[model samples]
Target: MRFGPETWSYASLERVSGQLAGALRSRGVQNGHRIGLFMTNCPAWLAWFFAISRVGGVAVPMNPAYTGTEISSILEVSDLRVLICEDRLASRLDSPPKQPPSVDVLMTSRTLQVNGPAEMIEHAASPDPTAPAVIFFSSGSTGMPKGIVHSGRNLVRIVQTVSMTWPLRSADGLFVAMPLAFVYSSIVECLTAIRVGATVELQERFDPDATVARLAAGKITSMMGVPSMYRMLLATREQPGESGKLRFCATAGETLEPALSHQFGERFSCPLLDFYGLTEAPHIIAHSNPAEILERPLSCGRVLTGVEARVVDDHGQSLPSGETGELVVRAPWMFDGYFRDPTATKAVLKEGWFWTGDLARQDAEEYVYIVERKKELIKRSGFNVFPAEVERVIREVPGIAEVAVVGVADTFLGERVKAWIVPRPGVAVNVEQVLAACRAKLASYKVPDAVEELQELPKGPTGKIARKELRH
Candidate 1:
């Protein structure tokens, strides 16, 4: 694995992971204990993740950009016993009022580097296949993020299935620029490469210039990114050398526009394959077959082996081909459930099928086309941002009377958060103040890109905010 200026072999990585697991055990970490990982993409991130799993503890991967409030909410729900965070990210957890005191903080620089006795300590046995292994928090419609738990067996099955589908050779090198906290990177980039014994080129964060330089140097064979990352890379002047080592470029986390796909393919001389899946399922249900990208440019491609996908209506009845409806999927590697949220879990999962809020249509040829999101979720630059979450944050501002958050189309970010506010009588509210409040309490992406003052918010007959009207 390569991260920035350092590279490590598989043997070295395993040794580090084993030592870290031993260190964690020395600090009272026990099997089935919940551990949080809040750090940027780097070697230590994977080392800590593997260490937690090595000792049979549940790993909770959280976005490093989360603010104190966001992190506190996750801690409240996840019941994390220990949080291994990067030195820089640990400062965000210092806010006294909202800081989680119950959770112990272990700096990655210090904790992960601590060496145990040379005598190797035997790690805990692997948990059952059905045992919860990791919890990935995804934005929920109700403003709080939901922790989706995936079993050890589920993760293994996903990696095995994906390896079979797109068999990566041992010599192949996979580039991972996206954050590992997200399921897309965790499963597709990190675990999949490990399962196939392929090298992984890691980046602390996505930088178009650095990534393009690596591609030009022929350092990576395949890369995975979101739509925004691809766009940035295409905008760069750097071009891949004629070596033709970089073969595949896979995109997920957002709808891949056809124009962007075409431009990327033409510029990089590589197939820009798009995949469709969610944190709940944690694997690509539909993907563009490398060989058939030219034939089916718009389709996300057919479902993979052992995965069932159907377009169903509001009543859960399957729709005919070419009819748009909610996409429901049943897969062997689906998540166990939302951690500590059985009510929310039951709402989406039923009868062994996950009701993906995404709307899609499948053609007669079994190719899937993502239409739109039926849920009130906003995807800004591939990060799920719930409208309610932004609305709730905006409402906390003193000058706001009522607020509504909606996503506006953007050429670069796919969608940008836009807030409309209703000011109280005789009280002046400015965009700067509202944005300042958001920046203090929310992540950078969750902050509204634009704010507009409204005389009064439009409401439906039921006296609720008319979000659809605001979109128009």
Candidate 2:
């Protein structure tokens, strides 16, 4: 793993993780211990992660940006035995019943800092593939994220699934600016690349300027990011030089707007393939390659080799091609249900299939097109409104950087359509102009009843627009 001027080799990874594992064992970390990893993206994050799982522990990777409230909630439900984070972020965990962790906090720098013998794992065998390996939380774009559990087997299945999408070679370098806390970054991005012995470029956080400059330097063959990151990357005037070896950029955290996808293609001269997955599924249940994304444009590509997907009605009957319904998926890498939340787990999972609360449709060729979250649909004057349909149209309007359509409460109608938009840095957006744009392409009830422009929109840990935040 390379971060800026410093690069950590596979030997360094083994050594550092060994030393960290020794520290874990000394701190009473045993098999199946649930440990919280609260930090941003870094090479050492992998060190501690490998260390936790090396000692037969369950790694709980937490977003450093999570509020004290969210942290408190995780502490209450995750049954976390230990929380390891940088010393700088220890302050944020000071909440709820005077701290919920039984084990002491372990703090380290963003770089490898463990000091101990490397023999801890020198002769040890590979970790169990089916043993609990990780507990990942939802992105909470709509509400509080849920804790989803997975084993090493689940992680490997998705890695194998994504590997078939990217034509990665061992000599190739993959750039990862997304945070390690997100499941996409861990399995789809890093593990998939590492499976072929590819090198990784890590970033502590996504900085548009830094990433653009890194791409211009030309060692990267591929990269992974979300739609929001792509928007900010395009907004920067720093176009990558011709030395660019970038083959294609993959995104999965959020829906990729068609306009944003085209802008990325025109700017970088590479395909911006959008993949789709859920925390419950770990990563990459369905994906697109360069040819498919260009040909189909709006489709989320075909389901992976070992996954099964269906759009079903409210009564749980599967819908036929081109029909809109809730998407339910079953994957070889499906999560081990939500941690300690049987009620919530039962609500989504039924008879081995995970009920994804997404309103989507399928093409005759079996491609998926997610329209909106089941809860995000707006009902105005007896009409159904999918937010993605409205947002896609609004996003195509000139001078709009990003847009999020939400359903707000109404007295007469059950709900009213509302839109929150962010214009280009220097452009000024007014309600009348936005309404005019929506009016041209939408039905009277489909148009936003209200429009408000902001400097920026609130985002969840995964960089998706936080519609719940926009509702208020």
Candidate 3:
């Protein structure tokens, strides 16, 4: 893994992880204890992760960008025995008026480097295959943060499934700039590459110019990002010929519309593949075929191997092909359950299936198309309006960088469609143009009743557009 000026081979990572594991055991870390990794994307993050796993500790990765209140709330819910963070962020753990509850030990990058014994080795049995080993927080969550737990074996299975679906070999090099606190970056991209001995270039946070330079110089052969990341990268100016040696680029954590895919492919001369997944099941659960998506727009590809997916009604009865309903899936690598929330767990994990709360449908050929979140379905004038459908149409409008459609209360219409749009930097957006595009492709009721523009939309930890905040 390469991060800034530092590079680490697998051997170096194993040694650092071993040393950290010994230090953790010396500090009383034990089997089943929950530990929080509150840092950005770095080699230290992975080393600490493997170290925690080596000593049989459950690793809880927290978004370093969260506010003090948000961080405090996660701490309360995480049951973390130890919390590790960068020295710069460790001070914030004591943020005034709401200092986070103290864990058994709070280790920072500086402290860990200074205190770790250089020659110590880790000696512990592997964690239970069924026991929770990692807890990844879900996006679009309400109230306190919701962490989805998975066993070590489950993580292995998820990596294997994605690696097979999105083939990568040892010779491949990945450019990873997405947030590592989420599974898409940490497991789907990062761990998946490691599973095949592929090298990676890690970025603490995304910088479009830096990323463009890396791609232009052929520093990496593969890239993975969310739609927003790709949008920003595409917005940056680039020369025509100096493109990355990318065989393919994968995107997830949000809907992948055709307009963006075509623009991205044209800009970088690489095939952009879209995958669908949840925090509960890592990614590449379903992936897109370039030709199939063109033949059937918005298709999220077919269900992957070792996985069963069905679109079902509220009663859990499976709907026929071309029928829209809640998307429920069954997979061997699915998450164990939500951490310490059986009541919430039971609500979604019905019998043996996981209700994905996503409104979607399947074609006769088994191509899956996600419409929107079931909860985000906008009810307008007694007609069901899926926000994603409207948003998809709005995105086709020129100059629109991102858009979020929400349902605002209306005494007469029950809920009126309200669209929040963020235009490309330095570009002027015509609300009339947005409405016209929507009118052309969408039903009258599905078009935005009220339009508002913004510099940017609120995003969840996973980089998916957060409609919950806009609704509030």
Which residue pairs collide, candidate 1? Answer: none
Clash count (model 3, backbone only): 0
Candidate 2 lDDT over residue span 1-472, tens digit each: 7888888887788788888888888888888889999987888888888888778889999877665555766776778778897777777766433456475678777766545564575433356788789998742333344778898888878888778767777887898876688787877788887788889988887788877787787767788776666777777876539234678687764556677777778778777888787778755444556677767777777788778999999889999999999999998999987777788888889988888888999999898998776767565533446777678768878899999998886543546799989999898767787787666555456789888888899999999888898888
Estimate, for each residue in 184-257, the C-alpha lDDT of model 3 and write its tens digit: 78988899989899989899988888888777777778888767677778879985554647787887655677
TM-score list, all predictions: 0.95, 0.78, 0.79
Judging by lDDT against the true structure, name the best candidate. 1
Top TM-score model? 1
Worst 10-residue lDDT window, candidate 1: 110-119
Off by over 4 Å in 1: 110-124, 239-243, 288-291
RMSD of 3: 10.9
* Residue 435 CA displacement from its true place in model 1, Å: 0.7
Task: Give the alpha carbon lDDT tens digit for every residue of 45-160 in model 1.
Answer: 88888889888899999998898889888888888888988897877888644656788888876234434457443465567869899999977888887999999888888888
lDDT (C-alpha, whole model) for all candidates: 0.82, 0.77, 0.78
TM-score of decoy 1: 0.95
Error of 3 at 256 (Å): 1.7
Q: What is the overall TM-score of model 3 with all chains considered together?
A: 0.79
